[model samples]
Target: MLEPQDHRLRQREYLLQISRAITAQLDLASLLNLVITYAVEMLAGTSGLIAIYDEEGDDLLRIRASSQLPRDIWPAFAPLLALPLADLPRQGVAVLRDVATDTGLNLRQMIALPLALRQSAVGVIYVFRAALNVDFSANDRQLLQDFANQAAIAVSNARLYQGVLREKQRLDAMIEQSADGALIIDSRWRITTFNKMMEQLTGWTRDEAIGRPCAEVLGIHSDQGVNICLTDCPLQRRPPAENPVAEGRITSRDGREIYI
Candidate 1:
């Protein structure tokens, strides 16, 4: 048996390793799998489950991962997810003793720790041990709580990142299909987004325009060939607007003068 200090040391190392693994994965499904697998491995639990709460008005808890549970008994555990989060302990865990005796499942004991952030619980992590007589010490609770905290942050970040990616995809689709010319620039005035319409208008393909300065690519000039884009750059003169409008004559890729 490891000494108390040694156990803590080992647990800390495990936490660091698992934290890296969790944060390294951005996909929600893959992150959940990593959570369950690391939970079972690090805690020496026989099986594990992670339930993520849906925040978009569903008030629903979805099971993100379940490992080594028999098909027939998984149904029994599913109902626990429907329980009022109000009933569960907020800062600690609720332990189930000898659940195998009650349900004839393979699990001997189980610990349910809420994945909490601030005062609210974002999700729950449950781990099962097959041992018949198990005693979870205060240190054990502390260790599980640590993992739960890190898991909550990783899950929440992944969900947020995924939502942003989906929204970006949706907007990109719209921008690509837009009728008028559309282009986007970074804070440094370098072209970051170039749509097909803008590509045609400027006669510069997206590959050629991205990362190039807007001044160089747009090459906007007055009718008398005086540089217009440099003097009236909207980003510098005006606050960012949703529907920004700029007008000038630009030299096309073919050296033709086009007025916008």
Candidate 2:
């Protein structure tokens, strides 16, 4: 058995570790698992569950992650998990009153903490203790609250990252499927994106073209045999408000001169 002071010191160290874990994690699923695992470990609870707010869910709250929660008793816990936000305790901790006596499971004690941000509830974390005699202490509640606050911020950030990633995927798909011979460049005028149409038109594989200078890939030159890309590059002269068109000729990979 550890002294109270030593136990507290260990708890603080564990909390610090969790702080680092949540900050570095961006994947929503992995973050939720981390939250529930840490919550259960910190509280010495038998199981844990994290439910995120979902408007389309039949219960309004969807169980996104669980730790040590038994599959057999999941159906029995539905009513408790589905409790409305208005009915849940807004501050501190409380008993899971929704757990019915007939549920046939030993889990009786619970600490429910709403994952709140800016006074709005984003989700909730539930830690369950199987032993009815062992009650959560005031310190336990406060420690959980502190951990929950960090977890809430992490969850919000992870959601934003996932949303941005999905949007980027959609945009990437649109760019690849576009019919135009599209090529993207960075500030240094290096090729960053070369789509299929560009690959076909320039006779350069995407793998061979990307990261190369656009001027080198296209080899565009005027009819007078002057390299247009090296002198008065059309890309640099394009007006911001109106699109500019400059015709030039390029020598393809097969040594054929193609007009653009």
Candidate 3:
């Protein structure tokens, strides 16, 4: 049995280890695996599961990670995790020993912890003790709770990253399909993106036109043959051309000059 001082030291070290592991990688699968693996090893348990609540609750809680749990039987327990268990009891913990005799879960012991982020519960960690006559102490619960909070942060970060990627993809698709010769530039006039229409009109692939200046790509001229790129840059005038339209000459890749 670990003395009070020894338990405190061990808990402190374990918490630090967990923090390092979770922050080392932001991938959701990798984070979940680290969490479950550490929990089972530290608690001296045989198996474990990390279940994350579905954001919309439209889908059941997802088994983000697991160990030694029968893969085929995991779905049978989904109903149990549909509702998240937020806070521990007043003792700051609970224990269900020999629960298999009553509930037939086949688990020798079960300890549930709330994966909390700030004031909200995001998920739960379940560690199973089999063939070990040990019970989790209050210190153990506190340590595990801290571990679960790290899992929650990893989950939230990965979810936010995924949302940002989706938005970028959607915006790119709209820009590519736009009917006009669409190109985006910063305040400095260097092209940021050149769309499908822009590529076709210029005879330059999107890859080739990006980063080139407007004057370099489209050298405009007035009907009087005034070199607009040098002398009559409408974009530089006080009241920039009422309509951002002007006749310009574009040099294609094959050395053909086309007027627009």
Candidate 4:
């Protein structure tokens, strides 16, 4: 058995380690698993679970992560999961809740904490003890609350990052497979994305075109023989809602003037 002081120090170390691991992990599944696993181990509980509210506003709480709870025992936990959101503790504190004993499960005590960010309850974390008299102390509740706060922040960030990544991938696919030549420029007027069709049109590969000035690559000239990119660049004056099409002559890499 660990000395009381030694156990406290070890709990602190586990919190530090969990904080580091959760923040660095962007994958939601892996982060949730890491959270429940460490939470169960740190609290010395027989089992634990993290239940997250559906983002689609279905008013449903689904088990996103669990540790050591047998597959058969999951149904016994259903009543707890189905508890109304209003019934769960949400004041940034963990509290003891009575677990049903008639379900043939040996669970006796549970410490429940809301995984909240700002004023919204995103989820709940529950740790269970099987011992008859092993009621969770105030210190255990506080420790779990602290850990749940960190886990909430990590979960929220991971969801946001995943949304951004998926959108980026979709936009990239559209740009790469576009029939018309397309390129994206940054605020500094430098090429940031040179799509495949642009390569066929300009005779310059993506690696060679990226970071170069858009005016230098396209070399577009107006009907009046003026270099429009240097004089009347539409990108500078166009309204955000407007998608105007202007025909211009471009000097290709092979010294051929191509009308586009």
Candidate 5:
């Protein structure tokens, strides 16, 4: 029998394993596989599963990975694990000592830990044992719960980073497709990004336009005939959402007038 101190040490080791596994990859599939494998090995569970909640349409728990469970069981098990966020416990762990003992239920010796973020349950980490020898103790349940909390934060961050990348790609495509010149200016009025039309119209390449002041690059002049770069520009007067577009005349490097 493992002593209380031994259990604590084992739990610490398991937590470290989980932390290392999560940090090892930004890819969701690799992260899910790591979580399931680590949970089964460290928690002494015969099987492990990770189910991620869909953000759109439904609150279903889509199984990301599993070990040692029948493929058919997933269809039935998904609904049982897909309880609403409000119904789950805020903190602490839950343990079902022997699933086999509960004749009506098809599962045995399991624990469910909510992968929570900002007091919401985003997913579930389930660990199960088919035989009595590898049954989860109260301490094991607590350790697994703590691991789940950390995993949730890691998963959330990964998802957010992925979303940012996708949004960037979409914005880039939109800029390329635009008929008019689309330029992104920084707080200092420097051109951060400009569409292909802007480059072609101004006789400037993307490489030359980036990081240069708009007035210096586009040659916009004020009503007083002063360089706009020397004056407070109107483009910076409003927030991005409020002022996405501006119209002005610019002189090309070749001395041709162009409307932007």
Candidate 6:
């Protein structure tokens, strides 16, 4: 009974809900739940699911909360659902009008949208209604399609954030395990970070070393007794491509010799 323009406005409002959901939470599971809940409510779907494919695309994991189907049914559909349907005749987004008439098994009045990133199909978003009284309209399909696109972006961002966090943890562990004193410097020759060994060797804590200029802190001297911090400082000058390692002798505050 809704007019075309009214449906369009509803869809816009639904998209705004999805956008706010993605931005509100950094946690992947919570964000995904919000998306699925919003999709089901806005599209008048009795049941819905959000599945993410494994890296090999051979397995699908149902991650979001669903309404129509019991949680027990998902594991059985994992294998078939995970396979990429990109080559199907309908492609990118596929819609089934009738649950009873549709040939696909275990799905009824379903809308499947491929989740793509960097031109590669990563997974699919599925929304459906199981009741015989419920029917999907063109407007519903369009709204679900837009919601799927937003879901794809949210999933990609969450994955990237998790990846960065994992890398940071790995780097921190490696730095902690290193035997030699190691320090990281930016292009400006300022100390960005260093390992615990560096702190112990120089009698300086990490808080004191961070953001300080390397030349002023390390006090490097040449063989000729010239202060390397004043001129020809390896830390201050850019390194040659062929010989990138910069080696110099530094005198610590207590007159200890340190090699950088």
- The numbered model that scores best in lDDT is 4
Query: Model 2, stretches more than 4 Å misplaced?
Result: 1-8, 55-59, 85-104, 186-192, 211-216, 219-248
What is the alpha-carbon lDDT of model 5 when measured against the actual structure? 0.70
Task: Write down the RMSD of candidate 5 (Cα, Å).
Answer: 6.5
Tens-digit per-residue lDDT, 187-244, candidate 1: 8989888899888888899999999999999977877777767877666665677665
Lowest lDDT sum, 10 consecutive residues, model 5, at 91-100
Off by more than 4 A, model 3: 1-26, 83-106, 184-193, 207-250, 254-260
Lowest summed lDDT window (length 10), candidate 1: 90-99
Listed in order, each prediction's TM-score against the native is 0.78, 0.75, 0.68, 0.70, 0.63, 0.67
**Candidate 4 wrongly placed segments (more than 4 Å):** 70-76, 85-105, 173-180, 185-192, 204-256
Model 5 lDDT per residue over 1-260, tens place: 45768867866776776677667755776666666766776677778788878877377788877767655656656434655434534311232322233323334556677798999877888887667555577867777777678768777878788889899889888997899877777888788888998887887888899999877887666444566545546665545346544345677777777755
Return the candidate ranking by TM-score, descending.
1, 2, 4, 3, 6, 5
Question: Candidate 4 — what's its lDDT?
Answer: 0.78
lDDT of 6 at 237: 50
The stretch of ten residues in a row with the least summed lDDT in candidate 3 is: 90-99
lDDT of candidate 1 at residue 76, scale 0 to 100 = 61
Stronger candidate by TM-score (2 vs 6): 2
Task: For candidate 3, write residues 1-260 as lDDT tens digits.
Answer: 66778867876777677677666755787778878877777777788899887888664577888877666767755545654454323222232332344345556666788777767767788887776468877866776777788788888878788899898788788999899877777687778778998887777787777888877776665556566877766667777768765576656667666677
C-alpha-based local distance difference test score of model 1: 0.74
